[model samples]
Every structure is written in structure tokens, then in C-alpha cells.
Target: METRYNLKSPAVKRLMKEAAELKDPTDHYHAQPLEDNLFEWHFTVRGPPDSDFDGGVYHGRIVLPPEYPMKPPSIILLTANGRFEVGKKICLSISGHHPETWQPSWSIRTALLAIIGFMPTKGEGAIGSLDYTPEERRALAKKSQDFYCEGCGSLMKEALLPVTSGSASSQADKEAKELARQISFKAEVNSSRKSVAEPADLSGFNHLPSSPEHQQESTTLAFQDTTPNEVSENQTNSASSSQEQHNQPASNNTSMSPRQRRAQQRRVPTSTNFNQVQQPRVNTNHMGSNALILLLVLALAALIFRRIYLANEYIFEL
Candidate 1:
């Protein structure tokens, strides 16, 4: 293997095996890179039938913890319109919320299966999944299968579950799928642990296997920094995008109507430029001179305006 799997790490080994399950490749369940980066992975799953996601293949991302089985993975559904925010963390027992509840014995496949099983549910307090009525869920679920992701720029597809439209889905099938998902995620966790430190520069990067071995050190670094830090290529790209907008000089929109002006202001995105290069400061004497000149000009203008106004008023009164 190009990237060594943590052998002493059983979690990594389990994840390695899970990578093999993707072999049954069909339309329903697919995992792919987020844009050009391999570190981030997206998945498309079929929602359980008789529930809202019955005919849908929801698309979402699986964020591996810097620490695998040691820590649960966080998921965010991008295409499933039934409540969860795009790219928001989907908290389950196997997610970040109940880290203590996650079992190393559990694999990525098992977790994914569990997610499918939960689809028919109302997810009252789930971090990502939403609670909606059958009607609303039906409306969104239909869209889930074909939903395209802007960030991924790809449509997520799912293999329809084989059982009859409303067969008694076995817990075993779900367990198997969850196990596979867990295995894939475990590889990422183990790998990340070995690659600790910030996510190294990706300029020379090619492929990062979703092997359980990789730990999410960069993710941890991102979360740890009270300031949003760009450790990965994606983060840097997003940060740069935001900074570019912020630094852009205001265009000549002064003639725009009030509504358009307010819309323009709201449209301007704000992002904390945590990695801006330093700029040189001007001397204090120059600043002071500029301030004094500006103040004198303002005083003169005010006095002239006041005298003109008084003269006009007196004439009008006469």
C-alpha cells in the first residue's frame, strides 16, 4: 500500500477491509472525492421505504475524526432536503455527540446502515437528520436521489434496496452496511493519527485512500483553533474566496436603489482572514497631518453651508 495502514491499529485494519465492500458498486451507494480533494468523501444512500426517504438516495459527506474508532465520524447530508442543513454535522450514537457510545468493533458500513435504518424515523434530536411530516418528507425525499451538490458538483445516486417496496428490512442488512461504513472510516482515523500535525500542503497531493489508518489531525486542528484555520486545500480555498470578496473594492453601485443597495450589502460575504500577510503602517506624523487637514475642510464646509442657509431663510421671510 502507498500509505501504510496502522497494523497495530485494529481500527485501521477493519477500515481497510471495508474499502473492499464498495466493490458491489451500483447506482444507489457511491462514495467519491469532494471536488478534487480525496481527504473529503461524499456518499449517496437510499432512504428506507414506507418513510419519507422511501424513493430517495440522499447525498451526504462523511467526516472522519482525526482519531478513528477512538472517535466517532460526523456526517452531513447535502442533498436530503428533509431538514438537515447542507454540510452540517449529522450526530448519531456513532457520531461526535456520543463518542463514548461508539464501539471500535463497529465499522463504517455498520454506521451507514444504521443511518438508513433511521431514515424512516423522525429524528427528533438528531444533529443532522430532521423531523418532518410524511407529506413534507415525501416531497423532499423524491428529490434526494437526484439531488446535485454544488460543493461536490456531482449528482448522488443510490441502488434501490432489493427488498419489496415495504419488506421487513432486516436489522442484519443495516448492521452489515454500517460495518462497512465504519471500516472505511476507521482507515481514515488510523491514517490521520499517523499524519498528525496540520493537513500537509496538498499542492503536490494525488490520492488519499479513505483507509481507516488516516486520522483527522487537520480537522482537529481546525476545530481546536478558536480562529477558523485553513489547514487543508479546501479550507484555504474557501478562506481565500471569502477574503477575496472582502478585499474587493466597492463597485460603483452608489446609483442603485435602496433595496438593491441593501441586497448588495447582504450579498457581500464575510469571512475571517486568519492567514492574511502583514501590511506596512504609515508614520504617525503623516496620519496626524491628514487628520488635521480633513477636520479643517469639514469645518469650513459646515460654516459656509450654515451662512447660506440663514441668508436664504432671511430673504424668504422678507
Candidate 2:
């Protein structure tokens, strides 16, 4: 095998050591590289006892890459294990399906251990997985031993028995628990992260609390600003009232000549005149003085005429 590949290549040497170690430490699974091609191997596995797959002997093929030990191998079950499809690549973290998770430290023995250990668990629905009932799986398991591999040139049961003198059931059960623990730990971590990532709802709050002193200050300033406006309004109302009284029609029109009445009509203030008052006008001060004098004279003359009329009426009655 070393003569075909680079005799001193790290990958080739590593596979040779892994093959030797797999024969001694654990014997429930046995593997041998093809005589012609070192990169391809055939494996035989004994199923765990007291499970649906109890007393089962399964055969499979393992195809390693040129960069193997650096790259993971692809595993295909040739026997009808009922947990996986026959003659198809099995999807596992240690298999070629998850190259990112595979480690160089992991060897053929590690993968075989994981495969048989997970037989009793439910299918992950991954590629090559099956969901046969326990009864169907047990029936298939009983017939797995009769399966023969052309490359290995031996029955499945004959290949697995020579490797193990101890109980295959005890070792498989121990590995199964370890694998379950690893899966549970990962699930718990994911649930905790989801809870922490959830967002909080804050749409219910509209107003926030403020200091009492700040509220008092705001009210005081508002009152101060409005006081001048109220004063200006009162002043405007008083000015309007005075203008109305002055513009009122003289009670006795007989007191004023037609020319004077016409002048009064022309001088009567309009909305236009009120708006113009806001503008700066030339000679307005003198005009205002003349108008005041004319009002006083008319008032005095009306009083005199009223008194004379009353005295005349009094004499006529006598």
C-alpha cells in the first residue's frame, strides 16, 4: 500500500498506525484496506444488544481521499441495517458529509463506534437515513449476517467475530450514552441563546416622569409671557370705545351746516384707517389736534342750543 502512494507521506503513515490501533483497543468493529488500493477499506460491525439492532452483523465500504486523515472518508452501508439505506453514503459529523467537523485525530475506529452507537436513536432525516419501525428493524437485523461482500470475500458475521473476545453489547451501550450527552449539551446551548436574542416591546409607554421643580418653572414662564398680551388687548378695547363715541352722529343735525356734516362724513374712521394707524404718517400730530378742537366746539354749541330750546318750550306752556 505504501509503495503505491508516497511511502513517506504523512497521510499514508497515519492510516497504517490507525489500522494497527483499531485491532487492539476495541474489537467490536473490524476494518481492512483493499490489497490493491490502500485508500479504500471494507468494514464489518456488530450491533449493540437489547436494542432493535441486537445480534446484527453489518458490512460497509469506506472510501478515503488522497488527502485522507486531513479529509474525512465516505461510508456506505452494503447490508440492510434498516437505520440507513443500503449502498448509499451515510451522513454524519465524522463522515464526508461534515468535513468541517472532522478532525485528523479521529480515525476509522472512532467513526465505527459512533455509527453503531447511534443505531437505537431516531433518524435525523439526513441523506441515507431511514425511519423503519423497531419490529421491522429487528427482523432486518436478524437477516444481516447472511450478507456477503465481494471485495472482502467473506460473510458479515465471520468478519466481525474474529476481532472481539469480550462482550460487544457493554461497549456499545457506554458509547451510546456519551454521544447522547454531547447532543443534549448542544441543544441546551442553542435554546439559551435564542432566549437572550429575543427583543423587548416598548410601545405601551408614551409619557415619562419629570421633576416637580421643572414643571413649576415652565408654568411660571408661560404666565409671564401671556400677561403683556392681556394688557395690550385691554388697551385696544379702550381705544376702540373712545373712537366710537367721538364718531357718533351729533344728536341735533340742525347745529351743523351742510359743509360741516359733509366734512364729518369724510373724516369718519374706517377699517382701512385703523390699519393705516399702525404706519408712520407725516403731519398726523397736527391733524389730531385740529380734530380734537372741532369736537369740543361742537359739544359746547349743542349744549347751549339744547338749553335755549327747553326755555322756549317752558314759556309756551305757561
Candidate 3:
């Protein structure tokens, strides 16, 4: 094992430490790395108690990735266990199928415990899962003891130690059972949340018509429901009222007193009246421009006259 993998590598060191810790077999489960390959391990776990798989000793393969502890390992069953397919990677929270949930703190022992815990639960059509009947599973459990592995060179019956009472293995079994229960509960909660969220997400679009023709008809009905004649009549009435307002000033001017006429002229100007008022400002600007030009021309003429007078005086002096 030392020559097969780099001793300095973290995965190698971790695996070697784990191998030392699990050197002895327990009644519940036992696993060891292959002599030729440190990354590959064979394991045997007793079926969870009081389930269809009770009394079954199932063999399986564990293929650890190069980045073990940081990544999850793959699990494959070899024995004819009714709960999981043979020679296929089983999907579990601790398996490679769910690396997002796998923690580096979890070890091979935790995985074995989880697997034992999972056997009694419903498969729910998950990959590598089987929904075999209880009778079939019981029969398979009886036959699993006779199953042998060519690679491990051990019978399933002899893979683990005999069950003992009040031992460390029993505690491990309890822990496994609890872990499996928690995992199953979490999965059910997540699935329920997804199912509830799906309808809410699609709720907004439900009121919308599904077919194009129905949508077009609804749009048309919306427009038909609005009274265009009333809107046009309102516009027409507003225009006539405004016309009356404009005519009222001129018509009432003859009857108005001097004070009333002055007050009317001081009122805020309408758009047309405002434009008329701005017209004279443009003429005033033009007048200012003409005045400026005249001042400039006068200044230039005065300068020219002064220059001529100086020239004449110079000629007189000469």
C-alpha cells in the first residue's frame, strides 16, 4: 500500500489512517482498501434491523476519488440486495451523487451507517434504487449470506464479526439510523417546497389566455368596451367651451368697465396671446442690434477723422 500511492499525498495519508482505524471488523460493517489499489475498498454491512433487509449481509464497492475527504466516493452494491441495483453507483446524500451535501467530516463508517439506514426507506424512483416487495427482499436477504466476492475473496456470511450486545458497534448502528432519518426528512421537506413553489411561479400567467386567438379576442373586447363616441364628444364639448371662452372676452368687452378691461388684460396669457406678446420682443432685439451697429460705425468714423486731422497738422508743420 505504501508503494502503490504517494505516502506524502493527503488522500493517501488520510486513507492509510482510516485503514488503521478500521483494521478490525465489526458486527454491523467492515471495510478495507485493496492491497493493489488504495482508492478502492470492499465493504460488508448488515441489513438495518426491523426492515425488509434485516439479517442480510450485503457486499459493495467503494471507489474513492483522488481528492478524498474533500469529495464524495461512489458506492456500488454487489450482492443481490432488493433495495439497490447490483454493479451500479447508488444515489445517497453521502455518495458521489450528492457531493453538495457530503461533508469532509463524514467518513466511510458514516457512509456504511447511512446505507444501512437507507435500506428500509422508499426508493421513490431514484437511480440505482429498487422497489422490490417485502417478500422478495426477505428471500434475497436469506440468499445474500451465501453470496461471494471474487475480488474480496470472502463469503458474505464471514465478512463481519458476530453481533454482540452493548458494544461500540451498537452505538454506531444507532447513530447511522439517526443520520438516515435526518437525511430522509430533509429530502422530503425540499421536495415539498419545490412542489409548493412551482404553482406560485406559474400563478401569474394563469389568468392570461393560453391561445393566440383568445388573446386577440380579449384585446378586441377590451377596446370595444370603451366608448369612443363619448370620448370624442367630450373633446368636442371642451373645444366649443374654449371657443366660447375666447369669444366671451371680445363680446363682453363692449359691456365691460375700464377697471374690468384692465384686469382682464393683466390676466395670464393663453398660448396664442403669449406668442403675440413675444413678437414685439423679437423686434426690440432687432432694434437693439441696429443701435449697436450705428454706435460702432460712429466710433470708426471718429477714429478716421482724428487720423486725418493729425495728418493735416503734420503737413502744416512741415
Candidate 4:
């Protein structure tokens, strides 16, 4: 009865809390802009150290579902041109396209960290992976520094970075930075490096079923797609075929008797109750003939099956 957008989703909540607590290389490399609308976020990631993108800052977008951890968020590489296709939706387990493997506990920070750690690996044949010459990747990665996503019109300004004064790092930032380091880097990122799987404990988040009303509404919507006229037409066709069969005569030959042919010429309804169900007259000879043919076909099939069984048995004995 009561429906409201779930802004304070558990996954987003935990992610925000953890993100706020983080500082250091992980935080420095990635910045999750926008805290109000948890469903949409833009992140800047520093390239994997010592790689071609080393010290490079990259920008990307993370679009979360209202269901939060219930569904995976889609990740798009906005700044990097290497290995990943720019602007196109990259297939990832953590994206909404695949819910089975996503985890509710996976924070944006975790996804960002894993994404950076994965860069040194080769781009060979991985989902959401792309391959560009090292030169191109590095160039884009360098440009990613100071890159802004203000031009993406659909995104909210509040969800984007606000102008700040003074040094970006503050005093309390130092302690959070130290804590961020203590968290051990679990290689939950797949070999593909484009997705972040939920921690083991959070894998079942999507298993929760929708509300009863949702199911009912979905069924109703599905039913509406089948028009009443279409169904009636199908039913009428079935009835007509049934009547044709009832009126048919018992002839196995290529030709029909005049009376048999006359009955066949009349279109009949398919109802079982020939009189009350509104069908044309039944032809006894045609019914008998059809029954006889069915019986003969069954007999032939049985004989063939029996012969096959005997042959197989003989071969085994040999």
C-alpha cells in the first residue's frame, strides 16, 4: 500500500559510511562525488601505480538501482580509453545486467579500489575489458586528472563535486587515511577487473522477493498484452477444426464418395458435443477411416521398436 523510493538502502548506507571513513591512496585515487542521491555517483580513480596509467587519474560513472545492493550497479569508463569501450555499458557482475553474482556489502570504495588494482593485468579476452595501445591509455589517463562530468545533463549537480577552498586534504583526513590502509585488499575483483562482487556474506541480498502487490501487478500487465479478440479467434479456429474432423468419412483412399465429399465441403465447428455445441453434422465414415489409420500407424511404430530392441539384444549377446 505504501511505496517510497528507497534512498537509504543498506548497501549505499554502508558504502557511504565506509567511504567517509577512508583517506589515503585509495581515497586519493578515487573520489565518490554526490552523497545525497546515493543511486548516482561519479568517481575519479588514479591509475595502478607503475603501469602505463601510473599516477593517471581516471573518471567514471556508477549508476545504482533504487534497490541498491539488491541489484548490481552499472559502471562506465568515462575517462579511460584502454581495454574498455568508452561510453558503452561494460558488462560486469556488479552491474544490474547480472544480479546473481553481485553482493550487497560491496561499497563504491571497494569497487573503486578493486578496479584500480586490476589495471596492471592484461586486457586479453575479458568481459568489460578493453584493449588499447599503452600510449592511448596513458594519454587518456593523464587527461582524466582534473576531468569533470558536469556535461552529463541527466546527472544532478548536487551529485557532482562542489567547489572547495584550501588544501583538499584536512587534519582529520590524516587519521581516516591511516584506517583506509588497514583494510586488507581482498581480491574479490574477478580476473576481468570490471566488476566488484559482493562479499560472501552479502551475496544473497537479491534473493529477497518483491511485495505481493508487485507480483500481482506484473501478472496483470502480462495478461493485458494478450488481446481478447486474438484468444477468441484461436478458440473459434479450434472449434471449426474439430467439426471438420467429426464430419469426415471413413475413407483411406485418395477419393471420397459424393455424400462424404458433400459433408466435408461444409465447414464445421470443433465442439465435442456436435448437436449442442453448435457444430455441423458429423460424418461417421471419415471418423472411422481416421481411427483406422491411427491404429495402423501405432502398430507400425510398435513393430519398428520391437525390431530395434531385438537387434540391440542380439548385438549384446554377440
TM-score of 3: 0.59
C-alpha displacement of 312 in model 1, angstroms? 99
Regions of candidate 4 where Cα sits further than 4 Å from its true position = 1-19, 22-28, 33-36, 124-128, 151-318
What's model 1's lDDT at 291?
70
Q: Using TM-score as the measure, which candidate wins? A: 3
Against the true structure, what is each candidate's TM-score?
A: 0.46, 0.54, 0.59, 0.44
Ranking of all candidate structures by their lDDT, best first:
3, 2, 1, 4
Q: Provide the global lDDT of candidate 4 against the true structure.
A: 0.55
lDDT of 4 by residue, 7-116 (tens): 46676565566557643333344445354554567666656545777546666788777676666778887765585667766654445545655677766665666456
lDDT of 3: 0.80
Please, what are the lDDT tens digits per residue for candidate 3 over residues 1-318?
Answer: 254568899899998999898888889989999888889999999998778988899999999999999999999999998899999999987899877577898888888889998999888888899999999999999999999999979798788988777658678778888999887776667668857865554443345467897667555544454588865775675675576587565646587654454455444333343343345433557778787667656666765685576567657756
Query: How much RMSD separates candidate 3 from the native structure?
Result: 24.1
Please report the TM-score between candidate 2 and the true structure.
0.54
Query: What is candidate 3's CA lDDT for residue 189?
Result: 71
Model 2, 152-214: lDDT tens per residue? 696866675444436564656677557645644644565576456432111111221277764
Better of 2 and 3 by TM-score: 3
Please list the C-alpha lDDT of all candidates, in the order they appear: 0.58, 0.71, 0.80, 0.55
